[model samples]
Target chain A: MNDSAGKIKLPTTILMIVAGVFMILPFLWMISTSFQSPSEVFSKWLPSKLDWSSHERIWTGSYNFVPYYLNSVKISVISTIGAVFLSALAAYGFARIEFKGRDAMFLVYLSMMMIPPQVIFVPKFIMFNWMHIYNTHWALILPGMFSIFGVFMLRQFFMSVPKEITESAFLDGAGHFKIFFRLVLPLAKPALATFAIIDFSWHWNDYENALVFLTSPELYTIPLGLQNFILENNVDYNGMMAASSAAIIPMILIFLIGQKYIIQGISSSAVKG
Target chain B: MKRRSWIQKQGWIGYAFIMPNMLGILLFFIIPALFSFGLMFTDYQFANPNVSFTGLDNIERLFQDEQFYSAVRHTGIFLLSVPISLVIAFIVALVLNRSVYLKGLLRGMFFLPYISSGVAVAFVWMLLFQPSHGPINEVLRWIGIATPPGWFADSDTAMYAIDVVQIWFMLGYNMIIYLAALQEISAEQLEAARIDGASARTVTWKIVWPLVSPTTFLLLITGLIMTMKSFSLIQAITQGGPSGSTTILSLFVYKTAFSYYEMGYASAISWFLFAVILIITIIQWIGQKRWVHY
Candidate 1:
């Protein structure tokens, strides 16, 4: 029995290690390829000559990646702020307020989640054109501000807040706004943080909508810029890989920092839904 | 009476909170949906924004469009691949659920592909599927299978190749969801089965499997909808392929609007795809009531 148990452990351990390595391979390749020279990218093994120059080039204005990175950071920051603020307020209203058509209206918002964004891209483009917000930062920020998932998830969190706290605040002559800002908002920190991290990561990595909407080079998000870089040039595999690797750093850092909240947020929301 | 008036007054504030999102949905979602439907009836072209309406012409052209037919075939192939990937994910989740060591780390490892930028993931797979000197071909050679088919380059295998990448990218996400569901299963129930001398296979089939069926059903329906909308990886990896063999409907619509400059026809196709997804979702919803076990 002891021997069999020990044998079982050995294969499971090996299987886990194999799976771990497979999962990390692409990321490892991305980093390795980024550090390779133009000639060494396609080599079977790690690059023979590791070049640190690409990293320097990206940072020190030699490479044109600064603008792309700046654009991504700007857009992600603005969108995250917008989404968190508006969604939180809306969530509070949905959870706390007993208004007419509230359930029906909330259902309308929830149903929007099922409609694939691709279906709306063309008409959105037309609308943006008419509004003259087509290729601007407003294009990215405005639409993202009113996230349906955000409102839904936050409403779930808000509902779980004991009703007594808000009711007491109301009894103490606090207005609805005061009760929300002072009592409910402070209590919902973890949920807000979770939403912020998710929204940041999503906007940072967003490619498809950004690709269709942003036509100008200056306005291009990281993924869009990276794709354009690949398409316009001869396969600069090293440069492309370098840019891609650089792009994911912020995401990795954000994930590591807020991973606990994000995991909790996802699981709790998933179970509830 | 004053307090009641105050409550009525705050109703507008609720609207205020929801106003931005409402405006966005109105402008970006609702209006776009309407325009897309209307575009189906007009000759909306980027080249000539002033083009006149052509009722049913675009929809009529869709019937004879060979590319559309091929795209339908490719989408069917993609739908077939979803179940295979889901099964792999489900099995992986079950194994991980039983194991004691480094489960979180292992879960994160699998989920890496899902979180990574789709473009970057596609690029990595593109390199992996390179006709020569790719690790995949290298492995194939080691197995004494010389000259494996050029995966994304060969028209016949292009869609299948894209499906493989899609499966790899999606495996961790679905597995994580399944893992979460698996964790909810009662340990006491499992222990009871163990005491009764039920084998692990029987325990799993009889106890764990039934409990997880609802999750499995949900994953199936969600996976189908998501796979139908999958275009980015295909766009990046194959660009609808050597001979449009990998041209699923989403990509077909994209090419129609952007490449072929036929927005009206693309809108029609988009609506058609939407209708298909809606129908499938409804069917799955009804079917789940019968077989999902929850």
Candidate 2:
């Protein structure tokens, strides 16, 4: 119905802007309080002076926030790389290569998507603890490597590749690895990038996994670290805001950079049955 | 012999490609899910290390447990926000679908909160909903309201307050999906309807809505499943406090297992939760045929 993209509806635009402001006010309040002194958190809605002490303290606080940040980076990077690689391989196999029971196997893989992590976390926790990997980065990294969404998304992209191109590569004596790396991977860059951004942010924003798996402060991700920071500094609204703002920045930056892909990925999967 | 050779080669390569993921899922997810059922029937404790068979005992305990019922009730109450949020999101998406100025910028603004960490959003909302000094209360006071409800602190209002936060958090996601669905509606149909003297409202209600029913059904099922299993928001904001008004099933299973070390009982409760979700999903699946035009 909105085929007239060049024509701007003034009233609807005004309504959207107002709604946008309503959506953005809480975030603005967060950034505002983050720069205020602790004394001004309740008294003033906006900070008069931009004080950097809250950021300074969180950076050098007793929590040793550096390691947590590093841990998150390491965990998210490794998990994204590993998950994307494995998912691509699996997707290539499922999409391009034929095997016995391939459809059945893919159906099994797809069904795993319906099982929420809560249904299995209890036993996984016990298993990890038994394996003596509890509270370690592997607990997060290893499990994050198994992503149903990654495989599913990549498969959709892979299936779109023309069969003739892959057959031509096979005719040139290229093996599965060579074709997957050289032919399919390069062609599926958009889908790969989409899944990468989604996976990275998901791992970055993960709190429940980190909460359940990591008990040590040094092993915490930003979300878990911010949780602890909130517990101890509940009254320290300035520091809490600063920490929350910091925790949110990386994801926000990623979203801004890949806004088109993120929204596309969301809509592509969400609109489909 | 040639065909057999090709089939064998392809099979080996296919299995090789999927080996890592298959192994990982097997170890982490598949096995754990199998163990979940086993864990439900056994008295497994972390510290004690005394595993004994107790068939159906955990399920019996769940039936008798009052807090389990409370968690279920709270989950049901929280899930009511899905319909509430659907209406809000639908209306917002309709507005957004119009030819509006600053479309990209406004859409990004609405979506910013969705990408932010749940903990951060919950913490920000906690500050906003603070009883006395919060800006929301300040606005209420400015309007000659003597006192506003203590949002998370009062048991009566705690669940609804959390529902408000959830609805706000999910509104952007739902709206984006609805917007996409709306945009997918073919212009030819609308043009024909307009030529037939049908009004815009009639076109929207009769043609636009039915065309988007599939997406609506998808959103409804996913939204219900998500809100039912939500934990981090409750954990960060209220921690299921104020007399257990916000203790949904996820929070209940978490606290029972970790806080109280009742692994067996927690496993059972989680299964119960799974059953609830499974049943609801099946019901929705069957019901969609009536309303889903596709």
Candidate 3:
């Protein structure tokens, strides 16, 4: 932790700040442009006056973003909860229970991470269409509720839970379900929270899946709805930026609140894999 | 009898625990993947309900598809982003690890783009790269450059333009990974190197780089796979436009399957994609043995 290497600290600090500016400038520009009037949007770097028309239009005008926001919240929340709960169950099984074919089952689950979803996108579309859920929120939410990555991550955390803890519970005649719910799940909250944040953000930003699956505008998530809004209002940068800022605010807030978990989740996955 | 019953009870517990997820994956993922493989050999258009089996016809057509090759080329070009992002991320992580002031603030700023939606990222960059009125060109003009390449609009630079955005998007994720690994390097070793009067460059190269190779390998593989399958940026930003210069394989697959409704052809294309991803993943597994130092 003693990182006071003074010789090159100033240069490194300055360099990182410059690079940080490169990273954050676009986001700052996004928020700035959203507040600019149409005439003032491209004329200057900063808005002359904070025009609320773009935000107002997106909320009240014909291009209402309320449905998109609500739908994104619905899908992300439902899928995040479902994925975490189900994956926790499976992780407990894989980590604690002496089940037949458990290792093989886990290997298959891990392999799911490598197979890019593009390969299955068409067929999943067909399947969802056949199931009469193609245009519904079910199309967006159902397929995402089972994340192999979540299972893989949580299983690692679960396995790290001391054997004696589980063994002692087992000796007390606590069944797998009882142990999972009463002990392991509580202990794995950090890992669960990490995966939850990840899953939520992934589902929130999922435009491609929504684009492929959902056809009804009413059921569209924010990403797909935003895309439609952009195409309809491509020349209206002010309005587009406003709508985009609205769509991105929730995820940004989530990241701000739980970014440590996000970074921890990612690095742990990397190191373990 | 007791042992057998206990074994049976344990099996039931395990099944109960795993059933919800397994059922979902089986119905949603495994079934669709298998059905897609079956569709690859058939001529299954969305309009025509009667699907006719056409063995190898789709594969034959895929070989002759010019857009497919164009997409493959664009994907290969985009793959350059993995190494580019890895190096940039590692350097940033290294520097950020050294300086402690406002570390969290700087890291959060760098990571904002990655957490933002693709639509937001694509739109913001598109506005920034707007040739006439955008700020990038304004800066370029002030610096005495009369014309900047019409980013995302000009065919010659469209792919590179997309690559730059992809790199920027990936840098934060990769940098976080590298930073975690770099910080884990023992303080004692760094102190030892300093006491021995080793230069910063040597310390980085000899100690820091080797220690972080495993993370670098992990980031490189994940980055490559993510970039290979990435299409949202193209969809939102360029729509693989400017004469298909930015058309990656995922976009092509999406277009073929949905836009054209050529499910069979799309399935074949996807199979090809699956094969490529499998090969790359295999290479990662094998190559990690050589370069990844645990």
Compare the candidates by TM-score and give the number of the best one. Answer: 3
The lDDT values for all models are 0.79, 0.85, 0.86
Descending-DockQ candidate ranking:
3, 2, 1
Interface root-mean-square deviation for each candidate? 2.4, 2.0, 1.6
User: Any residue pairs clashing in model 1, and if so which?
Assistant: none
Task: Say which prediction, candidate 1 or candidate 2, comes out ahead on TM-score.
Answer: 2
Candidate 3: C-alpha lDDT: 0.86
Residue A101 miss distance in model 1 (angstroms): 1.4
Encode model 3's per-residue lDDT on A173-234: one tens digit a residue: 88888889899888888899999998898998887898888888989888888889878888
Per-residue lDDT over B91-175 for candidate 1, one digit per residue giving the tens place of the 0 to 100 score: 8888787753677777777776766656766777777777877677877988999879899989988888888888887787788
| Candidate 3 lDDT score at position A138 | 90
Q: Where does candidate 1 chain B have its weakest 10-residue lDDT segment?
A: B2-11
TM-score of each: 0.92, 0.95, 0.96
lDDT of 2 by residue, A1-273 (tens): 344534548877987899899998888999999999988887788899999999988899775567778888999999999999999999898898888778988888866666667778788888898899999999999999889888888888788789889877776778989999988998988788889998998898888888889998877888888888887877988888888888788888899999999888888767753
Task: Please give the C-alpha DockQ score of model 1.
Answer: 0.47
Candidate 2 wrongly placed segments (more than 4 Å):
A1-8, B1-9, B284-290
